[model samples]
Target: MGLRHKKASAGGGHSTSGISPNSTNGTSGTSPDISENRPSWRRDPLEYNLDRSWDINAAPTTRVFNLTSSEIQAAPDGVLRPLFVINGQFPGPLIRVNQGDRVLVNVTNQLSNGTSMHWHGFYQNGTNWMDGTVGITQCAIPPGESFLYDFTVKQFGTYWYHSHFSSQYTDGLVGPFIVHSPEESKIQEMYDYDQVVLLQDYYHDLSAALLPGYLSSGNENAEPLPDNGLIQGTNFFNCSSYDSDSGYACDQNSTRAIFNVAQGKRYRFRLINTGAFGEFQVSIDNHTIQVIEADSTLVHPVTVNRLPIHVAQRYSILFHANQTTTNYWFRARMNDYCFSDQNPVLDTDVRALITYTNSTSDPAPTESVDWTYALDTACEDLAPSSLIPYDPLPAPQVDITYPIEISFQIGDFALDKAYINSTTWVPPAIPTLNQAVAGLQVNNANFTTSGVSTAFDSSQLVIDVPTYKVIDVLINSLDEGAHPFHLHGHQFWIMASGAHGAFNWNSYPTLNMTNPMRRDTITVDAFGWALIRFKADNPGLWALHCHISWHMEAGLLMQFQTRNDIMRGWAVPSDVLALCHVK
Candidate 1:
């Protein structure tokens, strides 16, 4: 069946806030009025909490979400700027659904520019067009138009949705997506409450406004440093850092997000790092958390005082509220060392309040003590080897290997560009999937190959896997900065990773095949390499790229044309193709 955007009923000028009441299964609940422009700090944290009463045992049904993209002037921190919000909320609204449910999101674009929504970590098996990746599966939903993203969520856990068009998500278009399942019943019992904790690096300027300087010549390693960091879309920014006439509307009354819990309860905080550039070291004063899930994969409980989370990565930790009935600090320290340079006005310490019931006062300096463990100097994710999957699924033997080298080089104009091998990606006028399907249907030899495809231009780096096979991808980084690499559509087994050195061809036989932390995102440290394997059974064109927004805009992305044998029989959706017709 074909999918199309249903027009809003006449006389109702599209409600710009809240999920549709007609949604089946469970709705994320009502969101605050976006037109009010109230800062997140003043709003109750419970309003942002996910409703835990969703019936997990209910039969699968379609869950509908109406999301409108528009620009609004607001201050996530204390500094005011124009933010692209969904349903008028900064950290968009929550989308919670059961594992087998179908998700139909009608994304209405009211912004001046085009936009698309990507359900991060969801494998769009037969519905590649629903992937919502601009330049890959489909084109952007042009201004004043809407697109229906219909897909079934086959996996369960914490996921998120964001504007896959350019660096728009960094400007505010982000929200949490949680998939519940009967399989999680055992894990669910350990927590008395569940909620999402968003961590992001806050910038005073819009990403579009900062792109020109970052992409200019002689700025190879310089990424725009954030002015501050945020937890649940709120943080206190010292306005004095900006000059009296700095042309910024600063409000010193901004406060930190407060998460209230009972003294002897357990909380499942699903942490999602939605920032454009910074990696955060997360911790709660005087509390050690048990990490139960990593990137949609349930893992054996691992206790740690502090958690290092890179951009686009997620971790669900269980926090036991066994402390005294008092407020404590919930810290998310931005790892500024990862940036080539720092903003003088930037505050690396980002905090929120973990207050007990009936306690509203802030924690005094001497009252709450942070974890004494030394901070992480390395800009990388927690060791992959340390997190073992709860379910033991041995990785299959590899059938082929593709070694890709990633680096940043100053090109002909002395402009910095990221490269995978010798190719740098520039979004084609037509998506790679559109090109691949047509070529495969015509029985083009180039499109039916087992390696790279020559059917597309040099700007598109596509590796074609014509049939089902266990593939190994060795990603080696040549740059000095650590990168968090995310692969779309599939969660691969992390065979091995190193902070330095090449993947030893001799060590292939000894690599861990006993469920080696299968995840969708991983960090390849500075001058490091990662070996990942996945079965090419899913039919579609998928992207593999750096999750860092600036780095991606610089061209650190590639596509995998998988299961072309199956894609050849597919027909492009008319509604999806319509997006490309817009100017």
Candidate 2:
């Protein structure tokens, strides 16, 4: 286990017996009456039409090589302003499958550049080849080639897939992969109403939303271009202003998701933040939200003053509507870009807004019982325990317990937001790139793609098979903003984070608890450090870095792996494995 000290936001309000993300004012607010008067919004208006069929010749595609936003939407007003996209769609189609279903994802690459698809958080059990681990798992899918992706759905939850070979993920190569329930996904869990919003950000021009552009192509002196790293993929009819026939002049990568809800009903809103860079304190037309689920696992259900979702993470919430006649405009108006730059052009953050149907004004709030908050619980915090027995195999094991300090030197408001690791990381897309950019060095090793393995080399998502245990990861901030640090696969407990200029190690409530907020990803406050711990349990390559879509694409990633578990008897069936040419 890697045990390290992290900085934390010490004294925030807890959810238990308190205000959940669902209601803003809390117990004092009047609750909604579910007795009678069912309006149309109470009938679950948010329905997603998802269809899954067999496509024979589709490989991993990236649009950065040629196409622009204009080609995808095909309308002067329809353009989504995508920088890097696959199939010209941001957050690709919602792929539907069932458990135990052997699916064929025929990927057809359209870009001139090579790319690969990595199904984020998809436990590649028997089909190791399907893991898409980039260098370790398979080679990049070249342009104009077709790669047959065959794998069975083993787990169910809200997961996604995107390009790992390049920065295509930030552009829009990824999409939702929904593993339907055994009932064929017919049993719709309606809260009277439902909604889904995928929060994303795009650079004005060549932010991570597009490929490397000229800058990332090893061009250090390239001229910077305009870019706004803020965006959400689809357009909707809520607080988002759009010209029905003739639209307003918004940025190139702007689209809004709209939800029309009637008053006095329970509404389920699934919130997924896939933005390149933007941590939000989301508000839905001033309505508080009850956060029921995180990532894919069900939490104890905590209400929050804000629906704070970073990149590559998902949260499901229940909203109890209190009105029905008027338009209740919901908005995730971006609170602050943690990486804010003075240049407003490049800071076109993707703000979220939802329009609801409101009824006669009672101004009466809803009283909510059955509310739960706090991530640390008995079930979620527990490690993977085997109800069944298992056989073991030989593997390397190294336990490390050293202090690794990572400093984030905060800069001025305008320049500080542009936190690219290197001048190269800015790509040519950055307008007036940060020239005195510090070289990316991880564990004090200067990272280089030349294969000499730099200290900042995110080369390995995993440390070679149980090679190092007891690793200490410490990210310190020399500034005053918050930064979220995420580790893949393994959820680490926050040992300590500095808030109020000191570490409340002993006073920290959930440090050693029977129930801890079991999370694989967590946000580190701006200008602070966050320490997390995790067991090197899972044996595969994994990434440790910022969940911010733009950050990872900008070289803020490192990898390690645990190989002690070779997965005995976990072999692909002869028939299924034969799909590939064995020579």
Number of the predicted model whose lDDT against the real structure is largest? 1
For each predicted model, how many residue pairs clash, with residues at least 3 apart or on different chains? 0, 94
Question: What would the TM-scores of all predictions be?
Answer: 0.93, 0.61
Candidate 2 lDDT over 545-572, as tens digits, reads: 6555434444445555444234222333
Query: What TM-score number comes out for model 1?
Result: 0.93
Q: Residue by residue across 482-575, what tens digits does model 1's lDDT show?
A: 8889999999999999988898999999998878999999988888899999999999999999988888888999999898878989988999
Residue 367, candidate 2: Cα error in Å is: 20
For each candidate, the alpha-carbon lDDT, in order, equals 0.84, 0.42
Residue 38, candidate 2: alpha-carbon lDDT: 23
